[model samples]
Target: MALLINHCPVRWHAIYHSHWTALQYDQQSITYQQLDQLLSALQRQLLTQINLTTPPSMVRLACIASNGIELLLMQLLCVRVGWLFCPLNPRFTATELSQRLAVLNTPYCWIENEQDADSLPTSSPQLQIDFELLLSNLHEQASSSIAVTTNISTSAITLTPLLIEPEQACNIIFTSGSSGFPKAIVHNYRNHFFSALGSQRLIPLASQDHNLLSLPLFHIGGYATVLRTVIAGACIHLTTYPLTVALLQQHRITHLSLVSTQLIRLLADPLFNAKQSAIKHVLLGGSAFSEEHLTALAARGFHYHLSYGSTEMASQIATSDNSSQLQVLPYREIKTHRGEIYITGETRFIGYFRDNAIHKIAAEEWVASGDLGTLKQHKLSIIGRKDRQFISGGENIQPEEIERVCLQYGRVKQAYICPTKDQQYGQRIALFVLFSDSTQFDLDCQQLKHYLGQKLISFKQPDHYLAWPLKLANNQALKVPKQVFLDSLSKQGLT
Candidate 1:
């Protein structure tokens, strides 16, 4: 399929005519024509005030802004100009942003807040403009100028759209870095295209669908949703900040991508059952969903597609359809190499940004995912992380298996198993849990121990239990970084 982008200005104008609409925070809507004019003016302002070349270069364009129509337009402009777009999460601290920008060697940085621009490091060359100022300036320019003619090509700008190949580095996405500092994973346009196309094959979304933009655009889940929508010629309903069940009902969202924790919270809400009929598919990933939670959702007549994906692979490797059975996509080829999950095919990323020395793909062009799993009957079942397995009493203990078992209990919402230092066993398992309804019902620790003892071998059972509030890290919406939880345990004098 051809890329759903128009190169010629007149062709783009004709193609996008009456095809776009902006859903603002206040529920106000703007047509595609208005959005185009706004983007044209913004593009002109960016060229004039931001010291950007008339047609931009292949240099990186960084932006830190809240979720809005302007941010979306900026991204589109970057794509049109063939510039690498790096969107920083608005939640990042100044220190974190500075450190990342330094490592990325970003020449341009756009900030929505003027104070943030003033606070930027002197060594970095940045032209920060507030969103309000940009919009106001564009509005003022529109009043004075009769025509806003954009020179798509300029001598100063050497970069052309076709010059940047599909394999060329496009975005640098940082991992959650719960273990250490975040690593910038380089992904190309081909990686994203294949990922979106592969996912579309599994879910079968069309132009009639309205995907809810619940996840943060900075993350792959949120970013992929946007790309999928555009590629499918569908509409996206954007929420202001935090995605809640109420917003889902208000927008009457048909499709949504959510983490396991978010799904659990939505299931707990009273309105979920009443409004769930409108939702056709909820793509669940980021972490493993408990069997009990799955059962609960099933009971509510809610449909879900359990997906397994990572940032390094763009988004998803395997995703289930409405049938509730996991289906691997055509572009993705999955196999088990020495009990470790290795994947290859079209959707894999080019490489990481920092470490060019490290080889990302195996001999067969398959990426050694570090995750351990088995393929049975052509279906993949992830066992756990091979590196996360601990030797206990001369036997290997996989935390994921124990956690999966704990999830069978209806009281347990989410569970994680970690190994703590043990003098005799070398390492013993520790269980961290988040209960679904902790106020009225709770999982008995003794009962869980006995239950696991009957199901799993003695070495696999957790030696201790800790109940805490679970929050997914900001970087990637996948796994809860075990290292982060371990640090928290140390801080509380529990480790």
Candidate 2:
């Protein structure tokens, strides 16, 4: 029983720090106290616009848009009023959106515009609300030039902005998994509370510091930033524009959240010097990364905090502050069972947002991380996903192991490997790779196969080779959809 650093009770929404800057989205900004007022305004607007005469105990709101001031407002409103805010990726197709909405049982879906509304199933159960109109009205009414939100009525409803405990559910985020099903992970106030606590203990952020939110809000990476900055009393730059060297310097961003791919791109840019960039911290979270790049950044005085966390864990279970080794943070315990990582802690996610309620977890209470890793001296190094393992002929094959070897080659930029059916071996390995942009390094199938052949055993080596596109989702961190990958293979006649 030790006191946690910066540990404090959960404040559903803090109305006190009104003058201090809380958010920096493009040219606009909002203070912590102003944020509280805006949420209240938006709550009144939700009350007037939506049908909630006999609202159920659990009310769910779905948002289809990129990150913005309005989306942040919706998120905070739900958090304060005990509503579940679900953000759907605008990249999802009509069928994808329809299927997910049905599962969510959502009565409200706030879309970016008319075009986004048209993209969703017109006949779906969820009522689509024009968020832009709401924002316009709010701006016209509010005196502060925080862009359109003052018009939002402050009329109190029966259910007020109640103080929610740490354990109460705050948000439900849908994450793409290997199971090929829409798994909505439920996170409570505590999950975020301690996650922020762990990160600050590792690398603290001050109120004057700014963290650039480059990840999508729908993903846990993006959601975690919101909670982290809020808890630290630090300002957040919520811009939709892609992170660039000029942009980072222009915004005077001290902290940033990025995946591995983004790191590589920054490394490639001659203007992005680790020592000169002035970025104090980079919260590295994602699937793939290289030690050479990490070492280079470290040598140049950059602090890349490698973290291993997921939607179920609310974010970072382990993080490396100054060193490359990821040390497990306090408020959580990390143990391995048969080489698989399992997390049990106050910050772990409550459960999957399932239908009805059998409120059961798999096996023991500890959440199975489904990741293979080595824990030594309380530090964890994630090797690969256990579910990513496949059998080739008779021997077990880990595609990530092969991909890791391929990444060592100077020309290889990105990689993806999966099992393709084979009668002789039961299953065979196939690879789709992207080589570094270079005229001299003209990588071909045979050349890559030859490079990997020396590094990997024949069984673990890929039997087939396909092209990897330069642009992938938000980075290599987010895996491509199963069907999308299959269709790409089919189109290339590689399947």
* Candidate that would win on TM-score: 2
lDDT of 1 by residue, 1-495 (tens): 344433412124324433344333336443333344455556666665554452333466677776676667666555445556677776677788887776667667777665776666746566544457645644554454343223111211332222234555566667666546877776666777778788877676665666887676667676677667655655667766466777777777778888876777777776786345467778888777888777767677777789877777777888776444667776788888889988777777766665322234442577787789877765777888777788988998888888888888767777887778788878788888766555542346666777888888777778777765345322234557566678766765655
lDDT of each: 0.66, 0.72
After best superposition, candidate 2 residue 446: deviation in angstroms? Answer: 5.1
Which runs of model 1 end up more than 4 angstroms from their true locations?
Answer: 1-17, 20-26, 49-57, 114-122, 133-168, 178-180, 274-277, 322-324, 355-364, 376-378, 439-443, 469-478, 491-495
Deviation of model 2 at 189, angstroms: 0.7
Q: How do the predictions measure up, each by TM-score?
A: 0.83, 0.86
The TM-score of candidate 1 is: 0.83
241-350: candidate 2 lDDT, tens digit per residue: 77788889888888998776788878877778765676889888776666667776777777778888878888788998867688999887889999999888877777
